[model samples]
Each structure stands twice: as structure tokens, then as C-alpha cells.
Target chain A: MKKDLKFYRTLFISTFSLSAFTFGGGYVIVPLMRKKFVEKLKWIDEEEMINLIAISQSSPGAIAVNTSILVGYKLAGIPGALISTLGTVLPPLIILTAISFVYNQFKDNAVVNAALKGMQAGIAAVIIDVVYDLAAGIIKKKRAVSAIIMLGAFIAAFWLDINVAFIILASGAIGAAMVIYRERKRRRV
Target chain B: MIYLKLFLSFFQVGLFSIGGGYAALPLIQNQVVEINGWLTMKEFSDLITIAEMTPGPIAINSASFVGNRIGGIAGSLAATFGCVLPSFIIVLTLAYLYQRYRKLTVVQGVLEGLRPAVVALIASAGLSILTLALWGEKGISDIGSINLIAVALVALSLFVLRKWRPNPIFVILGTGAAGILIYLNI
Candidate 1:
């Protein structure tokens, strides 16, 4: 089970293809990654994929890229992580750069302008779908604490317009506090 | 100098962007729009739309696009590197230690706390974009700010998403075409 040159190549190529083809963000890429790495390549197992998913979700980056880094690290090492990131990132960077060149011309064109505006609406709808999907998952779990945290976050952002960083750190703090409280309660028992 | 700024600002984006890429939006708006004034609210919304349609995460695409705009190809590379560096280091380090970290009560609690918060951030990002697209930057009070065509497009797009559930790229492209037709009719 040597992770030779061929291994890194496969790591780079598979992630490249995954990032290149997948259009939507986190929700789309993570599952596809599992299929490719676990189901197809047999590079990692189901539990490993699940762990990677959780790590990627909690970590501070694009879940897509983060997952790529995990699978790459698991397979190879630091170099694997670097190569896989290049694979995942290159597609969007290349495409967006090309688009930028013609962007000014496209920006002012009537058809393009109209289409872009329409795309905004479409994008909004997509965001709605993401929201619904995530919310449904949370609700299905039926955790009162989670529900309260979710609502608190919504209000802080939507109504108060709080900075998101503070919200995240604060939420993390609250979670840490919860653990401490539970620990004390268990000791008392 | 410009490259440094591109690197630093995006480094901040990468560092603070928790719960995934969409959660980065508010922070991005703050840096690119409010702090640096690199792009307007309108432009930022457009950035999100384009990034959404593109292949990578919104944070990376936006960094590339903005960095390119401000500093050229070097800027693009710099900003992209800045955007990804934190994730690479953090995720790689965590991946190894995660087996142990997952068991810690504090770590478990933090992850749990962040989940709902992440959802809120994403939902809020969506709401902010909806607000921007529909009513411009005026905090939603003025009915006059509403663009009827954009509103119409919103309903149509939502229906398409619910009914067909096609690849999002196609839906976005279709709406853009519809946008052209609306302008043409006018």
C-alpha cells in the first residue's frame, strides 16, 4: 500500500474533476467526494468519510476544499493535501479568470445585464433551497438546544446585523460552557 | 503592496469564514465592500451570483476575482493562496488529531454550538442577497426600490427550483437569459 507517484496523480486528478464539474457549493461537493474516494477509489472507508465531512464542516474554509485536503492527507501527506487543493481550486480559478477578461464587455451588454439580474433571482432561490435543506436536517434531530441556537443566530444576523465572526466564536464559547456545566453536574451526581 | 493587501484581507476571510463558504459572505462584504471599498453592494451580489455558478467555493472565487481586479494575475494568485492557506493548515492538522478531538466535551460542544450558528449565517446571507437584489441597499422600507422584473424573476426561479430541481448552473443561466428578454421587451 505504497502511496507512490501514481497515488498523488490520482488524488489530484479525481479532486480536479470533482471540483470542475460540480457547480453548487458545500452540499453538492461533499457527497460527490465520498462517492469518488470511498465508493469508487476505495481510498477511505465510510466512517473516515463521515469524519472528514464533520471536520470539513467545522473547520474554517470551504468544505469542498477542506474535504479535499483531508482525503489527500489521508492518502498521501502534506504534499497530497497541497496537490489535492490545487486540483480542487484550479478549476474555479481558471474559469473565473477567463470570465474576468470578457467581464467588462459582458457587464454592459443588455442581454447579459438582464441575464445577470435574472441569475441573481435564481441564485437567491438556490440559497433558499440550501436553507431549507439545512434547517430540515436540524429540525429532524429535534434537539431543543440546537433549535434555540439556530433561532438565536438567525435573529442576531437578520435583525441585529451582527458580525458573523463574533457570532461563531460566541456560539463556540456557549458550547464550551455547556460542556463545563454538564461536567460539573455529572460530578455532583 | 497590493498583493499584500489581497493576501491579508483574504487571509482574514479564510480565518473567520466558519461553518462553510456561504458563511464567509457577511465577512467578505465587510472587507471588500465596507472596509476596502473594492466593490459595491451591487457588485458583491453579482460576485456571489457568479461565484455560485462557478466551480469553486464562493470565498475562493470572490478572492480570485477581486484580487485580479485590484492587482492583476499576481493578485489573483496571492488572494487565492491567502484564502486557502488557513484551511489547508487547519484541516490538515485537525484531520490527524480529530480522532481524539472528537471525544472531548469542549470540542463536541463547540461543534454542536456552531451548527445552528452556521445555518443562521447561511440563511442570513441568503436574506441579505434577496434584499440587495430586490430593493437595492436601502434597508427594505421603500416599495419604490423594488424592481418588478427582478421580483418576477424571483418567483419564476423559485418555481423552477421546486419543480424541476435541475442543475443550478442551468437555472442561473436560464434566469440570465430571461433577464435579457425582459430588458429587450422594455
Candidate 2:
């Protein structure tokens, strides 16, 4: 029991600290997590790390949290998952709470406004970087159909102001249809 | 009743917010602004700005802010948990199944199709944020030409920096300085 508590405590602290300071969300955190979990701690192998990213992205929730939960669970089971998730989430929660409390007071503050404006620009760039990486992966796979789906989705959302969920659902339907079509074709052949 | 609704709503977000936290934005905006009437559109916009600037996932930060707005500390906890639980359960289950079906071509084909859509979703998110930040009446009315310039410079610098590989922190700070300069000049 004591050992379990110690493990949970450690897991929680590590996850909380990592999540607290991580910036730019899922893509940025991936490499950092690879370093920490695979290289430093040797907690999981490279293949597992890749699988974790895949599963986390495909599954619901925040990718960072999902990754932590999987790693934690892998290391120490359900308790570890709980502890790590709490750890990963707690710091950001506390920090954002403090920010929220002070936001109104600083709403019109000049320096704060400037800093945010700058960060906004950086965020746009980071997002572009993410898109570029994804595009490269898709291109490498020679998945032109998927590329078209992505383009259509972007145009739909950007030009028409369609909701994202609808796009995702539509894309999923298309994917399912393609699978069924391919299977039928193969059977006929 | 209100708290229960809050919990259930965010729980739904947590459950289906696949592809990442940014993907959750439109749903979150709809729920908080249109459906729930918890926040004004402006407030929701501002919350997104705050979420972007902060650490952790945007969805979690938004949940905390929205939660706090709705019901203080307890509300925040409820919303955060609600946002997280669904994904956790779903991912865990998927992770287990993934091991067995890892090599199936049909499964691969589906994932291949999903990847591009995810990219498109993210690009749309970027465009939406850009429109909100740079093209609003308030944005134009207040800052006018200077804001447009800032947006252009930022976008251009981002493009260049992608090729050159400068530290992202530096780029952020530089754009911040640009904002301050624009403000002072105005």
C-alpha cells in the first residue's frame, strides 16, 4: 500500500509539472514526451510511444492528457492513470484559475495586451507548422483522396463557416464508405 | 439542475472531442454561447484568447475558465472533470483494441482518410481564429490599418521563420514588440 502511494505520488508530480509548462498543445508535447518517457525514464519503448500518439490523437479528450493517462496506466495500472492525469491537469487548472482571477484587473493593461498580441502571432505560426507536418505525412503516404477530404473540409469551414463537428462526421462517413467500397471491389476481383 | 447540465454538457465535449483540443472549440462555443447562455460571444472569444496564451490544452483551459464563470471553484472542477472523463475512457478502450487490429489494411485505410480531415479541421480552426482576431468590426474600428499590418507582418514572419528556424519564443516576443509599437504610434 505504501509503495503504491509513493508510485502514485511520483506519477502525479511528474505529469502535473510536464503538463503545466507544456506549450502549443498536442504536436509540441509529442517530442517532449518522447524524450521524457522513452529516453530519460525508459518507461516505454519508441514503438509504444508512437502507438500512444496514434491512439491519443484518434481517441477523444486532450492529447496530452490522453498520452499521460496511457503512460501512467502502462507504468502502474489504473491508479497510475488516475494520479498522472490529475497531475497533468492540476497545474494548468491552478494556473488558469489564477489568470482568470486576475484577467479582469489586467484587461486593459498595455504590456499584457501587447504580450498577448505577440503570442497570438506565434500561435498562428505554430498552427501552420502543425499543418505542414501533417501535410507532409499525408503526401508521403500518397493519400490524395485523404488530401482532398482535408482540402474540402478546410474550404467548407473557412469559406462557409460550417461547424467543425459536421466536417469530422462527414469525413468519417467518407472513410467508412471507402472501406466498404474497397472490400467489395476486392471480393469481386 | 444547472450544475448537472454543466457537467453533462462538458462530459459530452470530453467524449467526442477527437483529433485534439482545438477541435473542441466550435462545440464549446456553441454550447457556452448559444445553447447554455453562460457567456456572451465576446466573453467566449476572450476566453479562447486566454486559453491560447496559457499552458496545457486549450479545451482544458477553456473548461476551467467557463467553469469558474458558471459556478466558481466547484463549477470549475465539475466542468474540467466532465471534459476529461469521456476521452479518457474512450482512449483507454481504443488503445487496448488497437493492439489486436494494428495491421489490418482496411483499418489503415480509414486512418489514412481521417488524417487529412484532421488537418483540414486544424486549418479551419486557424482561419477562424484569424478572422476573429484580425477582421472584426471592433478590431477594425479600434486599431484599423495598424491591426491589419500587424496581422500581415505576423503571418509573413511566421512563414519566413518556418524556413529559417528561429526560436518561436523570439518570434512571439518580436510580434509583441510590434504590437506595443503600433499601439504607441496610434
Candidate 3:
């Protein structure tokens, strides 16, 4: 909690390098972060690291950004959060900028187009796998409400063409209501 | 104006992208493709491929990619900052409040509900892209126009994913190579 220049520097570098080299996205960064902060730096303990990851997943936006912010805040408060976030986002910003330029140049080329078209099919397959795993995980829990909500959401988006923002809001409300109702019934009993 | 529009569009993506990066795809699709027409369906799919192969989060890679396409470097900066701002604010606030109250039951319940909904959203997005990849926008109506190669690639990709469970980056790379070899002649 000293909040020194050296500490901030180290936090920025640690986050920057971890983010720059890591691929696959938010989930990939978790173990690497643990290796660095919890094991090498000993800045945080194992238990706290788990808690941070949980919070990151539950919160909105990217998990990597959220985890970096939490770790930074835990170490040095608000400024630390800002520094860590900057470090985490910079690499992607730079990499994609160059990529976009090259992509624009070759985007209309038949070969590049063919390659991307092929990749699209593969991407679609991956997305399907993600959908299956996520839906199955919820259904495996045997929660009727979750299952119904999942089906309703798919219909609403795919057929009715409803805005997803509204669906998410309604689902969150239902969840909170379920908890509140259960609490009330317990009290009455 | 374009910069501002790009910023605001991605700002919404960041704000409501509950669950994680994949969960945000449908929302991003809505903003950039559906509403704004900034990128065509093909371009959007290409963006996903690039994002998958790249080193950072999908949301950030998307913001940068879509922004660069629309408005150039300054636009990428605008969109990336927009994407980052909400997370910065929300996480900082949650971190502060979490210090005061370690438990957050309401948030937990909300996440429980949101989880199923997020899964649904991803499924819907996947179906749309799949339809485009195999059948194009006419969907099933244009059955004769369907690309057999795309269908084969999708089948092969899914089989590989289910059996080996290799890293997605490798799967995508392999598929890209397959595309080059298969389509180069035609």
C-alpha cells in the first residue's frame, strides 16, 4: 500500500507483458497472472487471486481488463487501476492497428477473401461449441428458471429480433426477484 | 461526428457486455453491422477471425478493428477508449464498494440470471454467422447457392474441436490453410 513509483512501474510492466504475450482472451490471462503476482511477486495470496478472478468474470466488459483493475486497486488504489488498465489495453490497440491496415489492403483480394471465408466457417463452429458448453453447463445444474430463460432469450433474439440489452435487463431482474422472493418465504416460515 | 458515433457505439458494447468477451459479440454485431452498416457480414466475420488470432481481448480487438475500418487511427483510439472507459469506472466502483461489503448477494443473483441469457445471445450470433458462412443471406431459400466447401470446413472444424479440443488458434489456422488450398483453384 506504499504506492511508490517503483511499485506502479512494476505493476504496469507485469500487466503489460502478460497481456501482450497472452492469446485466446480473458481466461488465458488468469493462470499467468497468478504465476506472476501470486507466486513471483508475492503481491497477493492465492485466496485473494481466486476472489479477484470471480469478480472479474461476473462483472461486465472484458475479464482481463476487470482483473487487471482489481489487482491494481488491491495493490495501490485508483491510480493503480488506471495504470494497469492502460497496460492491458495498449498491446491490442497497437497490434490491431497494424492488422487493420494490412487487412484493408488485402481485403478484396480473392485469395485473402477465400482464406477469411474459410476461417469464418471454423469460427462459426467454435462459436457453436461455446454455445453448447455454456448452455449445457447451466442445464446440468438442473435449474428450471435458467433453462426457460435460456430458451426464451434465444427466441426473443433470433426470431422476435428484440434488442439484447432489454433481454439482459429482464433476466437480471428475474434473478434478483427470485432471490428476494425466496428470502421472504424463508422469513415467513 | 464519425469519431463520436464510433465512440458511443463501442461505449454501449462495453457497458452491456455482461459475462465476458464472447458474450459481447452479439451486441457488437448489432451496433457495427445491424444499426450502423459500418462493416458487411463478411467483414464482420473476418474481424472475428482476426480477433481470435490476435493477442488481446475480443472486445478491444473489435473496437480497434471496426474503428480503424470506419475512421482510421484516431477512430481506433476513440473506440478503444470508449470500450475501456466503462470497465474502468465499473470495476473501480465495485472494487471500492467490495472493500466495504465483502458479500454481494444481489449481484450474484443477477449474474445467475444473466448467465443463461448470455449463452442464448452467443447461440443466436453463432447461428447468424453460420448461416452466412454456409448459405449466405438468402438463408435456406437459396439452397442451390450454398457453398459445399464451407459446409465441409464447418463440419471438419467442429469434428476437430469436439475430438481433440486443440487450442482454437490452431483450429482457425488450420481452417485458413484449408481455405487457401481448396479455393485457390476456383
Give the worst 10-residue stretch by lDDT in candidate 2 chain B: B136-145
Chain A TM-score compared with the true chain A, each model in order: 0.82, 0.79, 0.94
Off by over 4 Å in 1: A136-148, A158-161, A186-189, B137-141
TM-score of chain B of each: 0.89, 0.75, 0.94
Clashing pairs in 1: A114-B179, A115-B176
Off by over 4 Å in 3: B99-104
Report the poorest 10 consecutive residues by lDDT, candidate 1 chain A.
A97-106
* lDDT by residue for model 3 (B19-52), tens: 7879989999888888899988778888999999
**How do these models rank on DockQ, best leading?**
3, 1, 2
Per-residue lDDT over A94-186 for candidate 3, one digit per residue giving the tens place of the 0 to 100 score: 999889989878988998877887898899999998888888899999999999999999999888888878888999998888877777899
Q: Model 2's DockQ?
A: 0.53
* C-alpha lDDT score of every prediction, in listed order: 0.84, 0.73, 0.89
Where does model 1 sit among the CAPRI classes?
medium
Off by over 4 Å in 2: A1-3, A38-47, A114-122, A132-144, A159-162, B21-49, B137-146, B167-169
Candidate 2's residue-wise lDDT over B1-186, tens digit each? Answer: 666777887886776567786667666765676568898654665676667656788788877887877777888888888888887788788888898987776666666566687777677665544555565424334544445664785577677677887755466657667767765566
Give me the displacement of residue B129 in model 1, in angstroms.
1.4
TM-score of each: 0.90, 0.84, 0.95
